[model samples]
Target: MPVYRPSEGCIHIDALSCLRNTGITIYNSAEPRRDSLEVSVRTSRPSCQLIERIESILYSVFQVCWLEPEQTAGKVKPFFYTQGQAVLNRSFFPCADTPSVKITYSATIKVPHGLVAVMSASQWHEPSADGEFRFTMDKPIPSYLIALAIGDLESAEIGPRCDILIMPPSFPFGGMENPCLTFVTPCLLAGDHSLVDVLIHEISHSWFGNLVTNADWGEFWLNEGFTMYAQRRITTMIFGHAYMCLEAATGRALLRQHIDTTGEEHPLNKLRVKIEPGVDPDDTYNETPYEKGFCFVSYLAHLVGDQKRFDDFLKAYVEKFKFQSVVAEDMLNFYLGYFPELKQQDVANKPGLEFEHWLNVPGWPRFLPDLSPGDELMKPANDLANLWSSPEVDLEKVKQIDISLWKTYQTVYFLDRLLEKSPLPSGNMVLLEKTYPKVSKTKNSELRLRWTQIIGKQKYTLPIYRALWASSETARKLALSTFQDTKKQLHINVQNYVSKILM
Candidate 1:
């Protein structure tokens, strides 16, 4: 009998076992199989005494018994974590790539004598004499969850359980890192540690996603939506409720911009969208599952009418379904069962706003969280924004409010409001630059990105957004010349985006 981790499908479970063990590992999951020249193979592992025979019962899958690995060389090099979005892990490993099944993986990765290796796993053993690092992930996670990186890495204690691994933006391979070492943009390091929210985001996933999970791509919101909700709950506690609301207000702007761009009817906007065969599930990703799903979850809290009670339900929900893959209905069923009174009242079947409608609906979220709590913070930014965006003059009022005094998100929210109200009288540009030099000079990526966007978009009418050079004649020549001098320093993505604006 072959040792297999339990997965929903027969192919997934069997193929997974044959893919990772010492005895007859499956490899080369790419290129389709050639016409079946009759072949039979039995895999065995000594400890488990696991054996399996896969016969001619086959679809097309190229399974290489001897693994082929990608190689690279460097005197002093870094290999950042690898995770192809969605289920593209097969490009690097021959493992079965499906979220429907979670796999537990253990690997002994060899590196240069002095280098370090890390995998996004629970346990790590010190490097052995032979320069091999061992890692074990007892948790069953979707294939994409496994990540590995080997480098001359160093670590610092960030928290009791958290360790900081810094990689400069110049690290070419540091595209996107997750898991054990959790790689992130260098920009998030504001020196003051104020912008490490992405770390909080990944940590939240430990419960809502890594623990319990979505069964398929269609229900990905269960992972991200819940994570977003969880992330804010944490922020609300660490910061005040007002700050959380202020920060969320910025997120709402992003969600709205995304919806407008994608056209609300796009299928990806649905909380549970269909993933057609052959289309990569990663391609279906958007803000819908995140912001819209957060709204839905937040609505549930609203229905309960007690923040404490809703939080208790969330805790109970995690307890009920940890370590399982489930669809939207599973969550709904569990929710209704947990709150019998709400179930009796038929809250889900409410008119014009049924839970089913929320799951299937497109466009704007039916319910928006009351962000008024942030108004205490938002009113200042809004007032500042109106002053800059206003046709008449109020430059004096804008100068009175210190931009530096505002927190990072407060600054971010102010800029986002400006973007929403772009095409200000060109005169406002002078006042803005003169009043808030930080907008042009700040090192904060979030603020810098927003400022650049305002410069890029302030003049172009909506749907025909263009760069600062296109409309702001005062900033045009200088912005273009600045690009000529510094564009090469920008990342390729930034270069292309800025290039588009200048064009």
Candidate 2:
């Protein structure tokens, strides 16, 4: 197909081939005297190969698949979706795949009568009566963020200006940020709303990542770090400061794990990294960008004396960079320009607070947020854990501590501490389980995962197997790690069940 850019005096010939999905070449042509130019070329649909497929079904990157029937046990129905990160969007259309290019798009999609088609644009909750759906995104976004999904879908309101899009069971990612339509896995329907944090994370991306994007993949922390910080802010608003801190602590742990595994010298550990030509951007993907970026942003907030001042600055930053792509230097320059005091050489020279040191230097940042507030809120849970860990402490006194007022995060913190030690004696495990039966029965995914970890370490085969089978896809790696270690102790039938579920 010929895509003519009369203004640029160029025509792009996009072609479909057997080996490669699509390829394009731009040729200089005489500028059109009229407002538009038209050209005709042989056109064929590109059959994009799936970058990765899970469960002998669901395809990642860009492709179509079939989802198992919702009501029928063995029946399957066609479900089409697109994941266009990196250069995958070019498979759909010939366009600049880099994040630096942003565009506003409008599309009209037609599907079967009963099916609904949605895109990362202004969309209707319900499909049109004629089965024709039209969408427009006034805000400019990179091509990778331009996604489409069509299926037997349903929606329900979660909050003001927020609704959940329930995709087929074959949906792999726990959730994807596709503007108004945030596609989520069916596993989130765990009875309890513990998985809604994923929703908050996606919503925050609307502002931090979608509105103000990183110029390229190398500055990915710009997209992730800001969104994570915003997600925490929203979580704190809804669930209180203590819950937010607990989540932040969990993220910090993940960041440290990535640093250790990937090594402190890895370029990906730095807040701002450089991507060499011909290198795939996905290789550098890790929690370092999300968590480490968050730490640096959080450090800046604290450095400016208070979160409110930092928050005001964030509002201004978003306003300044809305609908635009930026690099780390753009953000740093904005920070210095916004706060004249920060521009002083003396202020910039402070250890760990320097712009270049924080953004360019590898390893963990010298500055870390003081989580003393979280420690204070979690003192009760910590005290209970300490009592249980003490050799001379009375178990009865520990059992008597009132934990009814404790949040889910407090319970998770207590359980996490328990896992840090070697497995407890069987009798102690029994007593602990009996005292806090809710830990085993609770539907909260976070607490359940932590409780399962403790149980798995103690070699409590039954609970470990159950947790493995019930775990969310997002936690599959963690669940599998626990299962691998304890699988030998479990019954053959239980082992088979876990293998089937995870697979």
Candidate 3:
């Protein structure tokens, strides 16, 4: 029976400190009405505390009815909850989602035989069979972060530090890395070579992101960006550094385009969350946030240059913010505290070299030539305003080019100007590629992303797909963003590529 409403009052949760001293049993049964459960010791707090929290969150977001908590043998039992949805809505409950929630938990669950039962942390003690298993989490965690799953799963032991789980026929593409419990979708079992990189990306998140999180969604870049960076490192470690460098270069290129196009309305640090009258909690996933956030972090890593400094920055950020929420300001403050040199320079004074342009501006940069009313068009007789303006200028050639040609060329030129003026030369390959090779350079990220779209739609190449997946995470992500163009059938083609790479 349902027992709560969504919009409710403040329900303070004093830590469930005595959970270990009490008896708690979780049942993952076959009863479709309420398949899973949480049975914890009786306390002074009413069972409504857990019920109210779950009910309110589910009702407000998903608008679904969660089965009520029942009292049996002086303990409380909560109902079945989807593990996939829970990861996205980890903030719904006040309970810590971090693995280090500082409380110990023990669970006894039952599922259909031959299916594995998984949760956070390592399986404490040996797992029981017959779809029944007992697990203890010595580490603490928030309620929302607590997870349980039961399905047809096969696992490959990929060495001591890594393991790959393959899901049954029903799950989605790729998988969710929940530490020892990586949630795999049935699609990934397709045996595609490209999926190996996707798997590595998710596995890296377990430690870099899920283990250590941002203080809130605004600071979500920490979780995503850092993880994005870590994926490259892991890719380098497992694959090779040459591949990683090429991939990173591609990402930077795509990121430059991403920042320039999105405009000023969608800020990286935007605080407002637009929730519709009725929308699924998972519906908010968007490209600008995840992809661009990763780019931003990569940008910062480019700024620091030294690997030790970069590593220390991440390690320190995680250590300091470990059980807390953080914001963009916090990230800047932390970075500035460690690197005072960055604080001393004025962003404007640095010109195209500084983070101020990308970080402060609301949208991506555009290079189209200004064709506003009353603007002078260069003519055969157009006088050079500056004495230094080349006297040998080809006015006839300039007149022959159409305004649109000028605009395209202008965009290419502006990007070149940024590069000539910037400090780090290595990170601009993608940016250069986006703009056509001016003086015999190479294709930038914008061009690569567009190229991928053009080629991806017409014909699929395993190499292009691999290059898209392996080149740069930023470029791959940017290419993914282009699929948002609703008019273009390219999006569906790209999704096919995503499935191939991810599957």
TM-score winner = 1
Can you write out model 3's per-residue Cα lDDT over 1-503, one digit (the tens) per residue?
A: 12333465343332232233333322211211121222232345333224323221111223121222321111133222235332333322223333223344677767665556666555645666566778877654434345565444345556886545554322333466655666654344433243355677777676555656554333445566667678876876775564555444434445555555554475442222233334332432434445555666666666677878988888897778665445566766888777777667542236664444444554433211112211232221123111113334344553454333432222333333333233323433343344334422323323232334433321123345555566567858754554343212222334455566633
Candidate 2, overall lDDT? 0.70
Ranked by TM-score from best down, the candidates are 1, 2, 3
**Candidate 2 regions with alpha-carbon error over 4 angstroms:** 1-9, 12-66, 70-78, 123-130, 157-160, 187-192, 387-394, 457-503
Give the per-residue lDDT digits (tens) of candidate 1, residues 367-391.
8999899998899998888888888
Alpha carbon lDDT at 412, candidate 3: 31
Candidate 1 Cα misplacement greater than 4 A, ranges: 1-78, 164-177, 458-503
Inter-residue clash pairs, candidate 1: 120-180, 423-458
Candidate 1: C-alpha lDDT? 0.70
Positional deviation of 430 in candidate 3, in angstroms? 31
Best by lDDT: 1
Runs of candidate 3 exceeding 4 Å displacement: 1-81, 84-105, 127-130, 142-144, 186-193, 248-284, 346-361, 365-503
Give the range of the ten consecutive residues with the poorest summed lDDT in model 3: 26-35
Candidate 2 clashes between residue pairs 3 or more apart in a chain or in different chains: none
Predicted candidate 2 versus true structure: per-residue lDDT over 218-312, tens digit per residue: 88899889999999998889987878888787777767767887899988788877777656676556787888898888877876887888999
